[model samples]
Target: MSSRLYILLLVLLIATGGCRRGTDAPGIPEYDFMPLEAGRYRIYDVQETQYARNTLPLQHSYRLKETVGPAYTDVSGHRAYRLLRYRQTSNSLSWQPDSIWSVRLVNNEVIRTENGRDFVSLLYPVSNGLRWNGNRYNLWQSEEYEARNVGQPFSVSGKEFGETVTVIASNDSTLIGQTKRVDIYAHQIGMIYKERTYLQFCTDTPACLGKNQIEYGIRQIYRIQTYGKE
Candidate 1:
């Protein structure tokens, strides 16, 4: 089938089946009814290859803390999450605000909030200028942020699943023209299975493409969660 047809089919199936707009849908998973709980999750990620070829698929682990408050702070009240990433080999560490996220019970949809304001969509910082929302492909709307590389029938590889979402820095919009992307995958309940990121340096610095380092690790979540409480 053509890419357009495939995307149309995927969207239709997800809309009618994988994702439901109401509780009336049949065969609803038991987990769908229960409110998502607040807890900590670990994520492991690894990259398979290089831009031109697969190489040095690094691995790392991240700690995520999620909380759903009972009271309201701004929009839908207050919800929070914190993520700490640690590289196993180099002892490097990364941190994220654990941006607030919640589920829409009416349609089994997920939403996010920032600084206490509820939004139909959310953007989490990856580096200095970029952000990513996990459900973009499955989300109902893409009217929030301004995406330049937006294309019809956007494609995501099956390898992207089960990993933390990755993106470039919003501050560095210059890199936006370089075809930057955010890769995300979820794994082991609360863990991100594979998260890898790349940034095209447009500056004249040595690290800039053709100068030295063509790209930089804007962010990467490379931890494979092997065991979790089942």
Candidate 2:
């Protein structure tokens, strides 16, 4: 390669390196925050809110159960687990089939596929302020995510976890809209809580302009209700 081209290639590699963090340290329970144990499942209480231009924010609640299956080698040669999800409208109602996802851990980086989208859920060696691109494996543009509050006590939905870590997946704000996603995982237990907000405000009306009122958007919260192995 030409000298100029070689320098350019080196710069490109360095730039994309931040998209994924390299970690080979020995694993621990804290690193297993999202365990892949087969037959284990987690139940969550889902609180959803939807907003429209003229309607009051609609509120809906439900329950979700995510179950993991035995490990199998994927086409890419990575060991992956099947994730089957179910939904329940109420405690009295039986669980209905929801969706299927997949989870794989490669070099201490947790890769989860949800609805055909790939995302790096969590990174190993759980340290504070560690950042990586959650969308590095997919074709989508780089989306920065950071680990924070590592190995700290957290409480959610009346359940207190002795130690937990938070992943700030996305946080973007603008005059017209705002989008944010955060998830907390406890030691040995998977995700204990998750919250997401995608909001768009009215910019056409003077009264609501710059006020950031929810003209239309969706906000969802998932908190752990119970969990155990099947």
Candidate 3:
């Protein structure tokens, strides 16, 4: 072979090798905040506090267990996973059926539907400061949800998680203050903690006959006690 032809072939080989390396490079790290598989379940200790208009705050504690059921197609033709929720009061030994929740991953986004309302739980390429409308399809209220403290260490219920993502959902404005809902998800596991607090009290001095005049509100807290997959 001619010297120029040999040099040309060598150049082509180098270019091809570079292209191959570029194609074989490692992809973006997968954030397993929500691993959807059958038989995966998580148990949580839940505390619910209710604040009525003219009544004192009442608190109730319970145990909540959620399990992933079989996969199925929904009415909208999307492949979805069923979640069975069970709850047990403090004095109850047997768990009672609370409700059934459904979720699906579409276009790399986790979508959950409850009570005919669709919510975008998590988005792809999960990173800090990621924001989305969690209640976009809901008619009652539009909530702005943001991902904060992504891939951060978190501890709850005597367990330490290497990486956790916290999503905060809040309404624009309310009668009293901002209504916020927070969810914390651990890597390789699902949600480990959740909190929702909303309180509206009568601020007007004349309308407020007493100092404890809460119109309506509720506070809920859930902490993961244990989780496993099968």
Maximum-TM-score candidate? 2
The RMSD (Cα, Å) of candidate 3 is 3.9
lDDT string for model 1 (1-230, tens) is: 99999999988988887445565664333322123343434434344333321235344334443344343333434433322233333225554554544433224333443343344332322222333444354435443232222111222323333223332223233442233333232322332333434545445554553542434344444444442321
Q: Each model's TM-score, in the order given? A: 0.35, 0.86, 0.81
Error of 3 at 120 (Å): 0.2
The C-alpha stretches of model 3 lying farther than 4 A from their native spots are: 1-29, 139-141, 171-175, 204-213
The residue-by-residue lDDT of candidate 3 on 1-230, one tens digit each, is 99999999999999999999989985423887888888999999999999876677898999999999999998889888999999988644888999999888887678987776789998877889988878777777777789999989999998899999998876434445447688999998999999888877676666674444677788899999999985
lDDT of 3 at 136: 76
Order the numbered candidates by TM-score, best leading: 2, 3, 1
On the 0 to 100 scale, the lDDT of residue 81 in model 2 is 97
Q: What is the C-alpha local distance difference test score of candidate 3?
A: 0.84
In order, how many clashes per candidate?
27, 0, 0
- Ten residues in a row with the worst lDDT in model 2? 21-30
Give the Cα error of residue 229 in candidate 2, in Å: 0.8
